[model samples]
Target chain A: MTLIQFLAIGLTILILLKTISDFKKNRINLLAFLFWTGLWSSVIIVAALPQITMPLAKISGLERGIDVVVYFAIVFIFFLLFKIIAKLEKIEYEITQIVRKNALQKQNNRPQKKI
Target chain B: MTKLIVIIPAYNEAKTIGNVIQGVKKYTDNIIVIDDGSKDNTYQTALQSGAKVYRHQINRGLGGALGTGIEAALLNDGDIIVTLDADGQHNPNEIPNLIKPIIKGKADIVIGSRFLKNQSMPFFRRLGNYFFNLMTFIFFGIYTTDSQSGMRAFNKKVAQNLKIYTNKMEVSSEIIKQVRANQFRLKETHIKAIYTPYSLAKGQGFFVGLKTLGKLLILKLTQ
Candidate 1:
């Protein structure tokens, strides 16, 4: 109908296709693939039929359907951000372990004076 | 006979590594220098100074260096392991007194505290240290005069038991936490800090202190 709605639907379809491709290539697990598929499918539904969000906005005590969608998006984004940060910290810890192991192994292999 | 191993974790301290190694050599020949990916000639200087050097391929922070140093010490069968700053702020002569508690079986770990006695520390630095001490107490339920002290000596058992997870300055606080969790005997002794212009510039400032605090908080939440 509207230009914005058409663009949102197109973008959602593209993202959904990418998520499926990632799942096919084994880049993401079943749980993650299902999550993205559900999320993008909902986005497509919300974009295609803007009136569907009216009940959600009313129940959430929001003035407009767009506000409800925006609030959920913000919450979802924050959750994803927290996950990313936690994963990054774990990766950093792993890297430190690797570096420490290598340094110690190199030293052990070298001949040195007795302590 | 107790074997005392001194571990100096150096990062870009080429100017002082030679002198520091020589100073520690006065007390013990088992000196370990963990060259934490220094861009300078720290590794060469330490080697020339006759200290065994273990170098990281890339820069891991203070904690990472200390972790490597401790492992190296334990591998060499160190009876008592002492860690001090490479900036020459910690006096090597005080090391004998620092490990006295461990040698006598009085304590498993001895912390060389700068705040145990009256010392000339910068006003803000003193205040910041006090703040960190209080935070360590609040988060881990263990209070000490200097939670961030770079000079500490621990027995072999303590070294093997302690796990350093952080790769930054927060490792100091994390060490205190591990000491408490492992129920290790801890003691604090007064030691003077030689704050030269070079060493003063290397100490943690306001922003780094804040980052250390943030990391400590995360450590508390996660662990």
Candidate 2:
């Protein structure tokens, strides 16, 4: 393979790996990883294989097929982040409810012994 | 597990503090009242009612008092803890029901809902609660009957894990948000609310609601 071809393949793999690692560490959903890898794989195929890139780019109204894949991946990642944030909020609501209840019960129970 | 305890956060609630303490003592003996620097004799009256009192040197707001109470409850070997407002809007008779889920190991947290079943609240307050309740459901997918309800119950795990920074009423929203982030089991129980004219007057008005939402937005942005 030429130097450019080799670089394209290596860069795609690197991006896919980095995205997966970030997702795992942050507890991002697995679907997000899949979407990213799909885009990365598209880049390798679009650059290394001219026949696929030329026809697809022309039909999709894009100068480069790889750009479309990257755009899709970015949008998908944002959707995933929103889902995780919503989940976190639900957990917080439950904890607060309990804490407030515990406080009230303590206040109520203080008077019986004194009486 | 150590015996369960209760924490009451009071701020200038001298009018109702004694009755609230008396009402709670009928159900349980483990109680702690944190006077949030009340300008009135809230602390003295609570003490007179026989509650273990922790006086905040200065007014810390509801959230600050709650944080102090939670810290004290943890240190005191409290296995379970319940929190209720000092304004006497929450019914102490519902304590057993709130604690049941924790005892059954089904939930780390339980919230008392005034909107559940037959309970009723004031018109404007109910409208405000419904609006926030819808927002919480839309934003977090947690279908609680009352998002603004001040009464709640927690196990030691939850009480120990809490870290609230909101000094005002938005701490209510913050608590639910934290529970969602931590991925703990949550449940809601039906409870009666006693919203007297005084409490209704003291409750959140339009400006207070705006302030709370703004504070929550700012906190969310900072985090």
Task: Specify the highest-lDDT model's number.
Answer: 1
lDDT per residue for candidate 1 within B39-68, as digits (tens), equals 999999998899999999999899999999
lDDT of the candidates, in the order given: 0.93, 0.79
lDDT of 2 by residue, A15-40 (tens): 88898888979756788778777778
Interface RMSD of each: 1.2, 8.9
Residue pairs with backbone atoms closer than 3 Å in model 1 (clashes):
none
Q: Give the TM-scores of the predictions, in the order they appear.
A: 0.92, 0.65
Runs in model 1 with CA error above 4 Å? A1-7, A62-69
Best prediction by TM-score: 1
Candidate 1 structure quality by residue, lDDT tens digits, A1-115: 9999999999999999999999999999999999999999999998998888899889988888878998989998988887776777778788889999999888878865567
Runs in model 2 deviating more than 4 A are A1-115, B138-141
Question: How much DockQ does model 1 earn?
Answer: 0.71
Residue A73 C-alpha lDDT in model 1: 99
Error of model 2, residue B128, in angstroms: 0.3
